[model samples]
Target: MLAAMNRHRADGKAGEPVLTHRFLCPASAVSNLRDRLRPQEPWRLGLIVDVELSDLPHVLDAVAHDTRLELETVELRLPGKDRPAHAVDAARAPLGSTDASTYLELAPASPAVPDTLAACADRGFGAKIRCGGTTAAAFPTAAQLAGFLLAAVGLAVPFKATAGLHHAVRYQDPVTGFKHHGFLNLLVAVCHAVEGADPKEVEAALLIDDGPTLAARARGVPDHTATRARQLFVAYGSCSTSEPVDDLAGLGLLESRLA
Candidate 1:
């Protein structure tokens, strides 16, 4: 993803936050990170580290050796069954006054997710949703997606999404056969959320596949509404940036050079 972004920058400088990499407590992580950094790439924006609560100390110890200094964001993935507040407190201790923003990613199926989201919002931490996965079960149902986004909207908290989003509009993968959410679907759904759209309405937007219709709806969004929608939806992770960019170009959402 970072490589694609670097390839696209007209000035040849990295200018966007691409994705987050989990930091394991192994010795190899240090060397792996060092090898990952390249000259003139926006290393900070390209990859943020996600640290598990129990591994925070170990990760901190390992990172102390790196010259990267402060991380852009140290995402704390909360323990699946622990109390939200307890987990937040434990995660906060290791961060200790760093300039990096804190983001919390957790399972939406957890009964306490809403409460945990509230706690994260109160602390100004961003929220993350695992949208889809390599398998079908990893994907959240429309109800689940709507519920989480609606809850975030009510709390005025920003959120990011990951996995299963590889196209501009919803479609089934030819090889894997798993149905995936579309980035445009999500952006439009987010615009609805920003304008206080109901969960069903947001869900409706997610399931739409008509390319021109969806593009028209996206274009209809007012500039101010688009800004607010972007504020809440933030960004998402795509395995191939070109796939989505190409999809958008094909759909006329983006200008095509070949046209």
Candidate 2:
């Protein structure tokens, strides 16, 4: 993955690589992770780990030495239902001097999402949402996702999404027939949320399935609105790098050399 990113960066064809590497590892594996950390350019890195790991501080300390990788954020995996303030406090206890931002991963279906996002805003932490997974149950309904977006916007809390957003527009896989949310759909929804659109309107954006229509909506977003939206919806994870570029090119939103 790093090699492919480097090649793209060198070619300067597809634009700068906004690639990130997120991993799940134990504190004991810090040495192994250090050995594997080699990036040609500065790249954002995220670590998903248990909040109660014993050697987390040491692991973070070791990771901070790598100038090539920026420790963008550390995601805390809560063991069970806990108060948001308490969870953030516990996660911060282990970080002695490491300055990486912290975020609490919230399930989209959890009823406590709104309150948790509020706490994140109060405590200077970000939020993470799971957009999709292997099973159909992992994907949140349009209404559910809209609720999350609205709450995050209202609280002024930044967030990043992970999993299942491979294409630029919402699509149903022909092989599995599972519906997947599009990153572009999410971007347009963010624009709506930032502009104080109601939940129904935001949900409508998420439910858009037509590629051209969705692409037009994304393109129509005003530059200022798009900037504000991106400030709140910081980043998202995608499984395939080429898939998004291909989708945007196909939608006439980007230039591509692919035939």
Candidate 3:
């Protein structure tokens, strides 16, 4: 994975390779940290640990003050009602100098989600929405996703997405038959949302399957819109970083940074 990232030269420094993005490691994924550290190439920009809400206390106890790890974010899966608040409260006491960013994952339709996002924004945290999984149930419907985007935008909260977004355009996975949200589509939709586009308009953008057309729209996003959208949409995690980069290149929306 590191080799692939380096070959892409996404760090914008020829022959001076870096990850160009933060590598998210699950709390238990110690080997990833070791491998990244071994390179000693500044390959990682930041570290985010995925922690379960129930285990946050223990997680914090273990790493809250560990100077070795420059922890930037913690994404917590809300176990139940009001759990987002619980996670935020649990994290606040030990926030320390890291100024750790936090995100809560919740069902888009959950009644408590809007309030949770609002509270998270007020507390300087954000939200995370699961975009896909091995099963269809893991994916949010266009309406559901639009709702999440609207709520986040309305509350001035930033959010990140995870899983099953391996392609640039929305399409059905040949193996799973699950419709996956396109990473480009999501980015463009967020750009629209940051510009105050309605949920219906954002949903239409998310449902676009034409890769080039969607890429064109995304490329046309203004510099200011990109900045704000980056703040609100933040970054997403993908199992294979190369795939999304390849898709972007295919759409003519990206250029190789290599000299």
**Model 1 whole-model lDDT (C-alpha atoms):** 0.69
- Higher-lDDT candidate among 1 and 3? 3
Q: Which candidate is the best by TM-score?
A: 2
Better of 2 and 3 by TM-score: 2
Query: Model 2, residue 39: displacement in angstroms?
Result: 9.9
Compared with the true structure, the alpha-carbon lDDT of candidate 2 equals: 0.77
Superpose all Cα atoms of candidate 3 onto the true structure and report the RMSD in Å to 1 decimal: 4.0
- Tens digits of per-residue lDDT for model 1 on 1-259? 3354344443233222232332222222544655665554333432244545455666555455455533555555665466887776665776656656666776766677789888888787878888788678898877778788888888888878877887888888889888888888988988888888888999999888888989999989999989988888877766564576667767766543334
Q: Which one is best on lDDT?
A: 2
**Cα displacement (Å) at residue 98, model 3:** 4.1
- lDDT, candidate 2, 51-122, per-residue tens: 356668767877787776667677765435778667666656776767777767788888888887887888
lDDT for model 3, on a 0 to 1 scale? Answer: 0.72
- Give the Å shift of residue 217 in candidate 3: 1.2
- List the candidates ranked by TM-score, beginning with the highest: 2, 3, 1
Lowest lDDT sum, 10 consecutive residues, model 1, at 16-25
Question: For each candidate, C-alpha RMSD in Å?
Answer: 4.3, 3.5, 4.0
